[model samples]
Target: MQVKKCSLIALAISAAVSQMAVASQQSEAKGFVEGSKLKVLNRNMYMNRDFKHGQRNGTKSYGEEWAHGLITTYSSGFTQGTVGFGVDAFGLVGIKLDSGDGRNGVGTGLLEINDAGEAKDDQALAGAAAKLQISNTVLKYGNQMVSLPVLAISDSRLLPESVTGGLVTSNEIEGLTLNAGHFTALSNRNQSSRDSAGMKSLDLAGGTYKFSKDLIGSAYWAETEDYFRKYYGNLNYSMPLSDTQAFIVDFNMYDTKSDGLGLSRAWDGEKLDNQIYSLAAAFKTGAHTFTLSHQRVTGDGGYVYGPDGNSTMYTAHSMQVSDFNQENEKSWAARYDLNMAAFGVPGLTFMTRYIKGTDFNTTLSSNGKEWERDVEAKYVLQDGPAKDLSFRVRWGTRRTADIATGNMEDLRVFVEYPLNIL
Candidate 1:
């Protein structure tokens, strides 16, 4: 039944594409077709995780995987009319190169597991969205990727996750942008199927305002039917101390509680109520930036988000492994960033950060403590046959005092090249 439903949707999308293609060829639609843009990205990724203690369900020590991906995107300009119409589409394909002995148990975001609990060799996913533009407002419907303070698409893997829904964005007011949306289904980055069962529809509304060049504020509210409701707000301010020196401050907060049918209460025997907050200060001089931050989670429940959703929390310590979002958890972090361009090495950059977390949930451990360290280096080609090519290396290590299977080290290498196809 699921396959049949997916097939029908695919057919409908194909028909729409055909009609749009024909319409675009007409003289009246020249502007829409000529203004279209198409891009293709080639990405290669390698991931390795070494467990220092405990073990996964089927793995003993480590897991490793490598894959290559191709991502194609097409964005069309609106038709030249009062109510302009356009279409956008994207296709993704991932080819598995290697899945070591622990692939069966490891959930790496690089590939989907088959029914028999083995990783698939390859996967393909695609989506299309229809858009309408009226003055300063735009409306979009169908499958697409969305980013907001309340809900953000996960794109830290072979392919980014997409949602099936409708969204409206308006920027009629100067220095302000408003967005509202409803999402009914989700397609994971590594899976081909769109799943909605057991998941309630998500509704979100948000707005961002720039009060001045150095200050900005944002607020958002979101609710998942029968699941939970969340509220978020953020403030940012920057002060220029000198020509080459500046100080910046950031504050972010989230308040959440169970709503509707109280699904969280029914599933976990506890209401979903939590407040999370983060505050950070940064000092910048020349090409170097230093930052110190703190985050805290209050209440009996942890911060709420989708099971496989990306981390949109405003915490500085949320790394690849853990979010440090357990009940009553508190974390602190220090970070350093350097732009090589200041040293005559343009297109190269380096960053390193470390975070320490403690005071976890009482149900788990009263004095749980964990820490993580991350280092990253990246370079982008400025010009040549491989112009715009990019390479990045990331390494992270985490240690836990009381949690089993939570201590591990991870490394990822990525090579990407983006090309304009049209």
Candidate 2:
């Protein structure tokens, strides 16, 4: 790693502080039993992936799957004391709804597959974490979901991923938050057993600071044993022009380098050094939002993540079907979002985005190119029987000149309902 990459972590730790008053959270703590709560979510999802190239080079022609998932969680509030303690637990169950022998390929992340290439009928996972709190800082240990810029758990599939680890979070200062954690094992979304991903160890530290109501900044660093070290930084600012109009600018960047073990484990037996960054601007007026962004990747390899989480990449162009993260790649994107409530149709929203990448280096061609287009619609019940229930549909089409990726169309449908049963 470059010496300059250390600046990100330093900047986060040395951020300037303002004269904002921070209240003592421990002083208002409630008893554990009094603050305990339980909740459950029912999720039904169906996904289809159609390869336009169709089984070329021995790949699957298409992939499709449907599954129903039930997730239950319980969280106990801190006890009333100088030092408080609590416990959190989660249970997940995924049942295969519709998946044929040939349709349940690796592309469908909905269910587990056996050695005979058949999808499992059902899978279950359970985990728990114990937490202690003092002042405005908390320490948690055991299995849990971690969400940070460098290391995060992926929850895009039927069930959310989890890691066995210890995490410390501090909010002692107003408008500033700090986090640190070390994880030893990971459980994937489709598996029932723990440590399915077989991660050796991971260490992460990061912090986010709100400079003001309109501006915020974050920095993070992470290291995966035998893999690589990653450093990330972000700045986001919102400029309000009036009550109904505003402009936003967001920037994100990452620097990555491989370790000795990583070099040995590389598929092509090559070292890895990469830098990726993105800048985005958005304008919002009334119920509509327009966004434009540019992203670039440079160095010896593309952005690499996973065994950490699929959602670890926080770049602007990491879209539904493609990340546009090939080595020496430059991508541009345009997006629009609409809220139907402004048109007398409450609880409905729509989004569409297009991204194009060029000047990428690939083994097949030095000047590789790709593009993706995505559209999504979602609606939630406004009131009455299904008040919080939601339905969402997403479609994405991707075309690429890279030999590794075939042209494809992807579709996903989701129905979700949450129940509070404390």
Best by lDDT: 2
TM-score of each: 0.89, 0.93
Query: Can you tell me which runs of candidate 1 are displaced by over 4 Å?
Result: 1-30, 196-198, 261-269
Question: Model 2, 1-422: lDDT tens per residue?
Answer: 22332443333323311111234566577879888999999999999988765643366768899999999999998998777899999999999999995788647677888778888889899999999877777778998988888887888888999889878777777898988777888898888778887688888888999999999999998888778889999999999999989999999999988864783222245667889999999999999999999999987788877568778888899888899888889999999999999999899999999999998877777888999999999999999988989999999999986746548888999999999988
TM-score of 2: 0.93
In candidate 2, the residue pairs with backbone N, CA or C atoms under 3 Å apart (3 or more residues apart, or in different chains) clash, namely: none
Model 1 RMSD vs true structure: 7.0
Give lDDT tens digits, candidate 1, residues 71-189: 99999988875557899999999888898565533645677788877778899989999987655567789988887878777788888878888777765566888777777887877
